[model samples]
Target: MTRLRSAAAALALSAAAVLPIAAPAHAESRAEAQVNAFFGQYRDAVLGQNPNQDPTDVREEFMTSELNTELDQWAADHDADPVFRAQNVPSGWSVAYGGSGAGHSTVILTEYWAGGGHTDVWYQVRLDTLRIDGLEDAPQ
Candidate 1:
């Protein structure tokens, strides 16, 4: 969970290039919070030997179902992280969160670990709204 937060901070935020965005008036919205919590629980589920159980993909692009094999192949070919996990833990307020340009109102965090490799993930939020946008490598 801590790592997920860290990843969120890292992707949606940086020292220099992060343009300012408005913050939510009441912390994370109920919808956003629910999505965060939901994903947080599910992403962790893949870390074990649990076989493919979901009908979603790392991008929630459709990892399960009849397309499962295809999505898995794509992840491999693209070096995409399939088990990355993330959540929205609240980050105070902002003025640029009007959900303006870039479809930046959603956020997704994903964590991936393979053998002794370091876990990896990419967090993304709204460049305009300052909320989670899309987890780069998350399962739906």
Candidate 2:
């Protein structure tokens, strides 16, 4: 019984040691969380998981009017979905806080495609309103 208790304690200690290091990896900043939530809903809409919701409506809710207009033009120009920046929806995605300055914050969204490959979309968010104001391909 004593040996079992010692082994259990060792396991517990190991878990405890890993908890702090693992926690931050899962931690989402405010900007990241917002972007993540938006993407999740947008993806659902695009996939028709939410029958009542439209993907364009989702974009309007999260993005600035000017950005929405720009996205529309971009979609026409590229002949692809402007938000995904691709013709197909991604299989997975992640959002991260890039940086903030001049009353705006940057959010980096990496989209994982089916089969293989990924795309990074950079979003500019207004700090005060937290509204996404710009979306563009990752800078060269």
Candidate 3:
């Protein structure tokens, strides 16, 4: 009986130690959550995993109208996807809170490409509405 109890206690302790490390990390802020969700859906659409959804529609839903217009111009001028800042879609991404000031917050999105490269896109979000208003390549 003593050995059985000791074994059960050891198993319980091991499980407890692993639980936190095994769990997925969550966004730390509302702005981070919004950007993470947007990129999740946008990536799916762009990859054709969600055939019924359009990536442009996803942009319109998350981005302000003015920013969307600016992105369109940027795309035309650069001949690339302004949001990803690349012609190809990334395989995975992660979002983190950058900072907040002047009624706006920044979310840094790091996109990982299949070809062994990554890009950090900084998104400016309106704090009041929690809407993404601007995005640009990471400052040099």
Candidate 4:
């Protein structure tokens, strides 16, 4: 009887430990969903009107102030327009928790260019603000 109780207790403890791990997976899915929704809004705002238009000319009020400033500075410094061209590809988004807050996540997006080149875009998405605060070129 004692051995049976010990085995049951061990099983209960293991089950409790596994339950927390499952919760984070659900949280991560929610974060990825938020990123996808933001991208959908961006696609509508930039590409819905004119598919061939230069996206750099579109106003970026949808972005976080810091991200917008950094992108604008990059364009001004390089004397070239920076645009995020949309591509129809399979889901390749990956999200990591940023450790700052519950809604802070780092999202990796694989975006394709007009010339068939592909690049991964990294963004620090703060779901609280529903915007990306930082954007950087993903390392190869």
TM-score of 2: 0.82
lDDT for predicted candidate 2 compared with the true structure? 0.91
Question: Candidate 1 lDDT, tens digit per residue, 31-100?
Answer: 3453455445445444532255442533343122333454456568767533332222211111122233
The TM-score ranking, best first, is 2, 3, 4, 1
lDDT of each: 0.41, 0.91, 0.90, 0.58
Error of 1 at 103 (Å): 8.1
Give lDDT: candidate 1, residue 131. 34
Best-to-worst lDDT order: 2, 3, 4, 1
Candidate 3: 10-residue stretch with minimal lDDT: 19-28
For candidate 1, the 10 contiguous residues with the lowest summed lDDT are 88-97
Give the lDDT of residue 93 in candidate 3: 89
Q: Model 2 Cα displacement at 102 (Å)? A: 0.9
Error of 1 at 45 (Å): 1.4
Clashes of 1: 20
| lDDT (10s digit) by residue, model 2, range 1-140 | 99999999999999988887634355676778778888999999999997878999899899999999999999999999999999999999988889989998899999999899999999888888889998999999
Question: What lDDT tens digits, residue by residue, belong to model 4 across residues 41-136?
Answer: 455545455464334423354466666778778767766433342334322333444334666777766665554666666767676765667667
